[model samples]
Target chain A: MAAVDWGTTRLRVWLVDEAGNVLAERRGDDGLITAQAAGFSTILEGHLAAMGAPEAMPVIVCGMAGSRQGWLEAPYVTVPAPIGAILAGAARVPGQRRDIRIVPGLAQRQADAPDVMRGEETQLAGAGLPAKGRHLVCMPGTHSKWVLVEDSAVTGFGTWPTGELFSVLAAHSILRHSLGEQPQPVASGNPFFQRWCEQALAEGGDVTSRLFSIRAAGLLQDLKPGDAAACLSGLLIGGEIASASRRYGKGGSVVLVASGALSTLYTEALGLAGLAVRAVDADEAVRAGLIEAARKNGMIAGSGVAA
Target chain B: MAAVDWGTTRLRVWLVDEAGNVLAERRGDDGLITAQAAGFSTILEGHLAAMGAPEAMPVIVCGMAGSRQGWLEAPYVTVPAPIGAILAGAARVPGQRRDIRIVPGLAQRQADAPDVMRGEETQLAGAGLPAKGRHLVCMPGTHSKWVLVEDSAVTGFGTWPTGELFSVLAAHSILRHSLGEQPQPVASGNPFFQRWCEQALAEGGDVTSRLFSIRAAGLLQDLKPGDAAACLSGLLIGGEIASASRRYGKGGSVVLVASGALSTLYTEALGLAGLAVRAVDADEAVRAGLIEAARKNGMIAGSGVAA
Candidate 1:
């Protein structure tokens, strides 16, 4: 069986043996936008062939490929939906020789604050959250999600534009003058990052009002570009955590599904916001989720094994 | 005498009589960035020349022309300082035949929340708030300032990147896909604007969390580009107003120092947030400020007449 995560701008594939051990792996920039133009089946079959996948092997996919604009529209499973509903709602691609299914996303259908997530749903499914208890899962990315789960079912969630806001402000806003041509990487240890993160949390997530201070500090106090960048990053991430904590109520520990830089930043920020964090690698979670979907959909044998 | 409002990206010059009545006017895009390379004196003289000003005629300038990177570095007057201090601290351009002076901006030097305003301080000087009582002035722009003025003195202020944030998010973020290439004009009457404004105020200004809803609404509900843009605008402005009202408190009426579209939007948002608005034209305020500075510096006689 093969598992694929096809997002808006990235694609990853992993081949698994019947025992759920990885046999081969492939990654590419041929995401929804590119694959839509070049053709999804063409791209998927190429990767499968390059990995020497069997002609009749089944494939499970998640992410933007399941969106309305992607290869197949896997209709959203609205919360408070059971995790099993996601596997059951998988949309099978028509006219494909191999059995290929795309996992459906989750949607919050409230009129005032509607939201939908594609790829992250699969990650949530694979996070191995306690099925019998309430849980809060934090998946930080371009659109970070703070999800509420209870008894293996998603109850509610909110998305924060933390990463996207940081990117646009750093590149297009007047703060760019203070941040310089290329912003420096923000580390968890940077004092400015820690300070602004604490400040934003203290202020109850009122961050827009403090944004201009970065530009002013650069002008009045000669704040370095790197420090300014770190400050911006901290404020955005801190604001996200502060708002999320307020909305979700900081529980004992949040399940943080992230990897690399975002994971480090969120870990530091959530700690500053007074929450313990349980770590989960996003890549592994999604692969596990796809594998689980494959087994549930009868594409793979129901072996009592965890990937 | 010539009164010039030279900012980072714009230049406005008005030739005024001793009575402070504008005799001729010239506007150009030769702002700080352009003038820095073309020579500030050269651009000033060209505008002055077009307006038919005498070579020896004195000029009173405000805004970025007085910044460290401008024609001359007019050192900031730290607040709580009187409006007169801005006029008193004007920096004269050296080695120029014309007796040109640039009014100094006001700065709040608190280490925890340092803030500075270059162009808006000049507008504050001319906003004409009651000199005997405390007042909150909202100056909407690329960087919106909610200034606390008392007895003709500026005590403190907070700058919110409301306008800039709107621009960046609309142009560079995933929201751009929701908001079309050229987003339709967002009027104050747009229900999305009114709803989001009230919502942000109700949510205590935690707007970063709601930012993704604009994107999601587009994906799930097929929100039109214009409405999405309006929602973004409302959230940013409402968040700014909410956070500002929290810090400054909702007083009787906010002195709204703005004009055009911003004037309309802020007026609407502020009203929704439970504050009556007293509107002022930003152009008139800046000109009045420059004229006031000119008279204080003796470039123009202290005429009893007001412009």
Candidate 2:
């Protein structure tokens, strides 16, 4: 019995019987970056031993570790490449002790355009939700990925590091002094926040004048630091959404893969845009994706699979 | 006689006699970032010795080196802080046998709306050629500084790291593949460039959709990488200028302190906004700022007095 999901920062594993009954499971800090540096076998050995899984256990690996820079370079499925095709192309870890297979990524090139994505390939396939129409999927994070899916395939997609930029700006800019240690305000549609977004959107935002407003409103006008940071967050996220709409907006369906406060923030903001937002649980999607990958590789029965 | 201009990147010393006649000069790489780590005296020694100047020679400094992180921390001059004031508040390097004075920067504030500047003080002094009405001076670079002044006194200002942002986005993002090199083909005002900017401004980009265009335009539509990069540059700079107008656009003046391609770029863009443009040589301004600073502190002669 085996289950595993690997990302840039965390390593997760699960113990399951042939009937997919979870008797035990374990987790550790075996990320792709570390696994690449420390032998993947050694790290996996420590964790598997903890889970009481034997060396001969069959395990499925996904995420960043499946990339070229990963422990074992999994091949990429080019853009316009089908999700099912990528799942079928999973790479097997060449070791006699353990049965491990790494899922391949996806890529596409049409006309002169080209893009490639790795782990998302499996997640999109495992979504278990049928794709009958055009789908606009927004995956928010450091490098936020927005994908367009049609005919159960990833036709094309774009990525934005909205999360990374937001983090950096919040920490480094003048806004930092005002926004010190406060949680991002909960009011997604706060008036000051909307106004700030409109102001930046209006300026095409070389972002100079409106930025001074951040300091001015705080120093003279007495705008709260949390509100100011929230306002700035609004501008950045708003700017990103505005820029992205040009592409994926053409799609008729919208699904947002997010969780926690971020999901609330994005969904509330999107509500303002008059779009019906369907929020997906991030953790569930990760598991659903892994299970589907294992089934496609013949490691599990596709019939009545449970995640 | 001594004349030197220390900018962010290069150290240029003009060895001169009392008449401002050149005896000999030397050039070296000693931007603030580099000098911040290697002590200021080491950076100064190389130049002074190169010019055959004695350790006791009185050398004045201006620009960023006079900032808090510079060779010595020259204090910040508050808004409405005049050019002469910065010189008067110059900070001297201690322990060196040589007499050294660093010019102070300018500042602006409205109640708690306080912002300060350093290098532009000298640029305005050097451009002493005109101050007829309200004018706007823009110094474009990694951190492009826009200084608004009236009757020769700095009124208010803002900073836009357009160049720096452009550098980071183009060099780091997937967009980098398209932005082959600088001086890209898509001029800021071109139809495609304008459309891209307008869309981003109007729509409020989504991370996925906003960034996807770079790949899409190049991948799906067959747009060139350089042109793509240029379009991105135009969008950012245009957005910045647009943002700046909202704050400082209310009937003042316009001047620019920059050189090379950057100056031309900002000048053309700002021209699109109908603001009058003029430029002050950063190198010369640093020299003049230094001289002015020395005199304010009794290091150099007053206007009529000789060294």
lDDT of 1 by residue, A5-80 (tens): 9999999999987776888999999999999899999999999999999999899999999988899999998888
The DockQ-derived docking category for candidate 1 is medium
Q: Where does model 1 exceed 4 Å of error?
A: A303-307, B303-307
Query: Tens digit of lDDT per residue, candidate 2, span A84-112?
Result: 66676678888546778888766566532
Candidate 1 lDDT over B139-189, as tens digits, reads 988788889989898999998878788878888888889988988768869
Note the B-chain TM-score for every model: 0.97, 0.82
Model 2: what TM-score? Answer: 0.66
The deviation in Å at residue B170 for candidate 2 is: 10
The global C-alpha lDDT for each of the candidates, from Candidate 1 onward, is: 0.87, 0.65
Model 2 lDDT per residue over B70-120, tens place: 777776777775555556776777898877777667656554234555676
